[model samples]
Target: MGKPTGFMDYSRQTAEAAAPRERIKNFNEFHIPLSKEEQQIQAARCMACGVPFCQSGMELMGMTSGCPLHNLVPEWNDLVYTGNWEQAYNRLAKTNNFPEFTSRVCPALCEAACTCGHYGDAVSVKENEHGIIENAYEQGFARPKPPKVRTGKKVAVIGSGPAGLAAADQLNKRGHQVTVYEREDRIGGLLMYGIPNMKLEKHVIDRKVNIMREEGVEFITGANVGKDVKTAKLLKEYDRIILACGAKNPRDIKAPGRDAKGIYFAVDFLSATTKSLLDSDLRDNKYISAKGKKVVIIGGGDTGNDCVGTSIRHGASSVTQLEMMPKAPDQRADNNPWPQWPKVCKTDYGQEEAIALFGHDPRMYQTTVKEFLKDKNGKLCGLITVKLENRQDEKTGRMVMAEAPGSEQKLEADLVLIAAGFLGTEKYVADAFGIALNERTNVKTEPESYETNVKHVFAAGDMRRGQSLVVWAIREGREVARAVDESLMGYTNLGA
Candidate 1:
């Protein structure tokens, strides 16, 4: 270890984002970066535990505990402690092909499983991770080193999201002719469109795509596998096909007047805003303007928070988010033990902005939108809201919500974003390839083998497993690559 007693000498430190009042007005990143010294000190807090469960990335009690990418947290922490910026980046990239994306948006299961978190705050893993990769880019350590040997094989990967990119990168490294097909206009599917630009700058994704191009990975945009592009043609042309297509279907809120003009899905709205901005500027795109309008969001997860932040930037008159379930406790309960992430309620960036502008956090617990009211021209005018009480069904032991008596109220709403989450990948893509689907509608693959029902066809990422963070997608990509390589050569060495 770089410093045996370093954990004692350093108290955890991290980047504090810009105050909500200042940052809400713009779409730029808000984090105030940690200085080199501060990052080094924070890196020193990595406790060299015997088991180091932080990188285990297992599903425990229905919650993810360790790093899903199985990042070498302690090894890289020790590297950072010894002032090895280049080495640290190497170690970081060994498991994760794109640390920059995950560092910003991932919930950080590594920190959740940190042993030090059992007593105090976990190590600043996300910050240290971002720092290492940024330093590597600055030092010219990260580059496109394409493989020299050509295996005379061609592979096609559907979807240009994180999983597809990771799989493309690995196969390209192993001397396979790789091509990625993205349904969107841009290369990154969710990263470029679904996620708001403030969280992950579009330029970051562009930079990586350019590097991958230099590495001999061909990217074809606006090529929807089943719609525009023929899936059967790709199957015939490529020696192997990989389905990294994400869970693209969004869950809709079935309420009265849901078909109104202003009520929209979070994905459609976010995508439209980003597409317009990328096409020219915000002024050119005027599909759904939140400017000078009351915005009501119907989900309280990260996507809902994103809608709040984005709407605030669009000059929303007011933003209110609603949660259908009861709020989590402020601290972990008896059932939540050490090395387990505490499920707690706290304000994220969007809520911070809402609180700063409107007097308090905008989230309303156990509240849900009952019905959408529309104007004479069919534009959404307002929403009827109702409070609900949660109860357990004795027969099925399932949690359910019932409308509380006389809890109905009306509020002006120009826009209502349905951020309830995704319902898994679209059926057409899987159906196009005639692959088997799990009960969840995700691509079905046998354990340890990413191969689908069709021969030489593999599935990975959110398409294989429902909606997930970038880290888990990357891990799935790498594992699937080894499986594909073995299927082709009859032997493989890729690690999970």
Candidate 2:
């Protein structure tokens, strides 16, 4: 540890964010990072526990509680405290494929399991990572170093999101020729569009993609395998193929008048905004506009919050979010002990913006949309909502949602965005390749291995697992790379 008593000496401090009213003026990263000295103090707060759960990546209560990449948290924390930034970045990159992405977008599972947080505050592990990686980039420490040798084996990665990028990076470094195919116009599948620009600016992704390209990873955009390019062509051309396509099938809301013109899936809404922003700075007005409209988003998850923020920026008249589940407690309950993922209320950035602009919290817990109200033009004008209650099912003894008695209400909504969540990978892509799918519609692969029933064809990330975080996707990508290497060469030294 850099300072034995650093935990007691310094209090927890995170980077400050720009005020909501000010930040809503433009789509850009709003968090202001701490200075070097303040960040060092934050890093010093890491206690370096005897059993460091921060890097354990354990599963507790059906949720991850630590760094999924098993990042060397303590090691890098000490490095930050001691002013050894290069070493800090090296230690961080040893495990995580992209600290830049995680540092900004990850929910910071490490902090939930932090020992310091049991009583006081958790160390600023996420911001410390951000500091190290940004410093590395600024100091020229993070640079492309292409592999010196070539194995002459070719590998095809069928996606360019975090998972696909991680897999391609690892395989290329292992001296295999790797090419990533992206169906979208740009690379970074979900990273390119699913996520909005304010939370994680698109330039950050482009910068990393450029570096990976310099390291000899070929990225082909607008190439949809199994459609534009045949699956048989990939199977024959490449020695192996890995499917890292994320869960793109979005769950939809079924209700009366659902075919209204103003209603759209959250992904399509968010993607159009980003595409239009990048294409013409939103000048052409190709995206669904929330400007001067009353926006009602269905779902209270992160994506819903993103819609809240994006709408506010577009000058929406008002915004509200509906969540079927009950609001969680402000603090962990007795059943949710320390080291378990905390089930508590968290007001994220978008919600905060909503509150600032609307003068109240936008989320309505234990509520759901019952039907859409449409104008004569078949455009959505409002929605009917109903309160829900949790009750134990008589047959299965499982808790289920039931409508509350006499709690129906109607609210105005010019535009409705469904941020309910994703289902799984689309059927057409998997069907074209003749790949089997699990009950959840994810690509079927061996439990521990990424290999599918079809030899030399593998699946990873949300394609193998269900919908998950970006960090988990990166983990799957790295592990699957190791699996592919072992299968091809009959042995491998790649990290798991």
The candidate maximizing TM-score is 2
Off by over 4 Å in 2: none
Error of 1 at 405 (Å): 2.5
Per-model TM values vs. the true structure: 0.97, 0.99
Compose the digit string of candidate 1's lDDT tens values, residues 1-496.
5467777877888888888889877777778778777888888888778898789888888888889888898999888988998889888888888987998888888888888788788888899999998888788888878789989889999998888999998888888999999988899889898888889888989888998899899999889898889887998999999999999899988888888988888988888888877787787865467888899999999999998898888889899999998898888889888677778886788888888898878898899988999989999999999999987888899978989999999988888888999988899998888989999988998886799999988999999989988888888888888888877888876656
lDDT scores for all predictions? 0.87, 0.92
Candidate 2's TM-score reads 0.99
Residue pairs whose backbone atoms clash in candidate 2: none
Q: Count the backbone clashes (under 3 Å) in each candidate.
A: 0, 0
Tens-place lDDT digits, model 2, residues 1-496: 7578888998888889999999999999999999999999899988888899999898887888888899989999999999999999999999988999999999999998889999989999999999999999899888998999999999999999899999999999899999999999999888889899998899999988999999999999999988998999999999999999999999999999999989999899899999999999999999989999999999988999999999999999999999999999999999999899999999999899999888999999999988999999998889999999988989999999999999999999989999999889888889988899999999998779899889899999998898999999999999999999998889988876
Summing lDDT over every window of 10 consecutive residues in candidate 2, give the lowest-scoring window.
1-10
Model 1: weakest 10-residue lDDT segment is 1-10
